[model samples]
Target: MADASAGRAGAAEEAGPSIRTLLLLAIPALLIGIASAVVLWLLDLVSGWLESAIWDGLPHAIGITSDNPWWILVVLTFTGFAVGLVVWLVPGHGGPDSATTGLSSPPPPIGTLPSIGIVVLISLAGGVSLGPENPIIAINGALAVAAFARFATKIPPLLIITLATSGTIGALFGTPVAAALVLTGTVAAVRNGGSLWDKLFLPVAAAAAGAETMHLLGGQTIAFHLPPYGTPNPIDFLTGLLVAAFSAGIGILAAFLFPYLHAGFHALRHPVLLTTAGGLLLGLLGIVGGPITLFKGLEQTGELLAHPGDYSAGMLAVFVIVKVVALLVAASSGFRGGRVFPAVFIGVAIGLLGHAVIPGIPLGLAVACGALGIVLVETRDGWIALFLGVALTGDLTLLSTLCVIVLPVWLLVTKAPHFEIEPKHGLARPPTALA
Candidate 1:
């Protein structure tokens, strides 16, 4: 009698996963959020350690922190060589091939984990001009899928993807709003034809979760404290219009240059050679650009926006031109990164040019406002543009100033077809891509 009962239970268990199986797999969504925050925190921590090693131990190294210009050519060439060698020798030499290939249909492939780790550690450690967030998203998403693979039931992949993505989104930005907007837009862009309402759900939760997580971890929450209701000065509005259009033009040109430069690098077919060359090129640019344009634009943006008094009009204009060029080169040369910081840097330079004419606005505040205003025109996401620009300067009182300039600038950029280029990797071939 006992034997018979045991046999029946075994049969049911083998039949299929219970509904609880899905719940168990999906519940890790919160963990994913925590994990995402942890990774960024660690990235920050690790970067500090490695920077000390390079600066103290490798003094002869050009631009220990800045991408040194005098030796930029050398650094770039060596980086290129190293990149090529790694591709030839490493387990996942091909990487994700996202440049010409387009976004991976999946956020990341399980097989590329080893290479992803290598690229991230080295890029961050070497003081390469890049952001960790892109690879962070890809790696986290890959890990999420691998964990969920053990489930026996037919769990929807989309739900799992959304959950894992939200986790990182919430963690990294500290404000779910920015992370949700960015990640959700990316997911939607890659996944064809998803409805508006469907896309909104994950981000909304992630955004809320991000804020809560920030509070939990004792991080600052960002917001706008506006000036009283009234139209901005006519001069401010006109200046914003000119600056917005100018910076956006830089962005459009940068986008156009990416593919060509990426293709040029691919012709080498050697990751080591490619990355080394990129590194050296960055070093040289740093020397010439005075280290202002080196590395990812995060810390640099803060300094420039905070102390606009340091730069002359000629220097600001030069900074904008060189920084844009260097970003195109680094990304195109097979170096992994994000453009948010770089974009903000360009906008700040534009702002400085304006302040050259009207110095009363406080160089820091002027540069900060203009940076946000231009990024709004370039990216066309008013919230993010505002968030990045204002958030960088540690000020929100200027958001009203942002409103005066960003909208009109965005409007002008909208009519230009160059704003949205067709995806390089071919569009979905079969109608059933979601499958």
Candidate 2:
């Protein structure tokens, strides 16, 4: 009995990866991580560059600073141009399926990368209320798969997939914790797929390597700081639950609007036309919402957190409406990016709404808290969303504690139907003469 136990321990110890194996996997993962960061950073840079060029050229554009009644026409026209180009020139660049694409899917993107990248950038830089995370992730996943297959002598298919998934973990939403949540979910999925516990090491290594690489390369993500808070009381719990209820509605709205907006612009399909039109709409809304609603809301989230009460009741209402409309316009118009940032923004709006309704709570904090709560509700990925909320507020205690409070309600929201889609292409055919 002693010998058997000893033998099992020996095997387990050996079965687990050593520092050496970690380094081996880390080397490749580091490369992939660096690549993801570079690509992400470049994508942002491109959007910034485009915005500057566009604005410089058209300073007097009517919709540039305010919502004109004709703003809808402008959005339609620009999107029509984009859709025309995508359908006419780009053969299979369907971009991404925002309407239906949810999280999770089968291995590796085979096609639909450049189109996705282009679309996201166009939307974000064109002053749309979105960020460039999700599309970038899918693209990164594809790149990792391609690289894995090219190197490593017949690396087991499962290992290749795990490695690819891991490569993006550290770079998840531009934070290590975000990467951990994503990779942890991925690991859960893999474990469920088969009795392949050994494969987890590969992804762990890849994620570590990727994160370390991002650190080395100075690929810092955008800054957000959630505030600190005291332990939740019944009041906090009830408030969070209420916010979750609203957030579920927000998620559904986001899901539906995301697709409808895409279809709206796709109806036109001209790049310049779609972009110009979307820009015009956003610009016009910017007139009332100010520049805050015109571009990706990432930069302004912090400002909102800092002075939530400064915004008037009328202004908050307009801000919420413009952001929702702008997200639809940008996402639907073939712009490339994720709606996560915009979703967070919506959460803030909801939080503010909550305080407004109640009349006694710290309205600014309430708005921020509600915003953070809704993120947990929408993504069904709590810790990272929690982190994002905290980061947004620049107050960790407040955000983290709020995260704890909101967790129960957010988990309840998991029962809500999420939007999901499969990859654009079907799997490769097996050999004709094969078994």
Expressed as tens digits, the lDDT of each residue in 1-435 for candidate 2 is 999999988777546456586667667656666676666667767877876655443444543532343443354345435543553466445455453343333232556776676666656555567676566666776676677678765555445544544555465444455555554554554322322334345555566666666666656454554344555556665665576566556666665555556667667655556656666666566666766666667667656756766877677677777777777666665555566777777677667667667655554356556666556544667666666655555555466456556656666566764433223465332111100
Across 104-179, the per-residue lDDT of candidate 1 in tens digits comes to 2346667876676666566655546665556666676677677667752354666555655566656555666665
Where in model 1 is the C-alpha error above 4 Å?
1-27, 60-77, 98-105, 151-155, 183-202, 207-231, 358-369, 373-380, 394-397, 415-435
- Score candidate 1 by lDDT: 0.59
- Against the hidden reference, what TM-scores do the models get? 0.75, 0.75
TM-score between model 2 and native: 0.75
Candidate 2 lDDT score relative to the true structure: 0.58
The worst-scoring run of ten residues by lDDT in candidate 1 lies at 426-435
Report the Cα lDDT for residue 384, model 2: 60
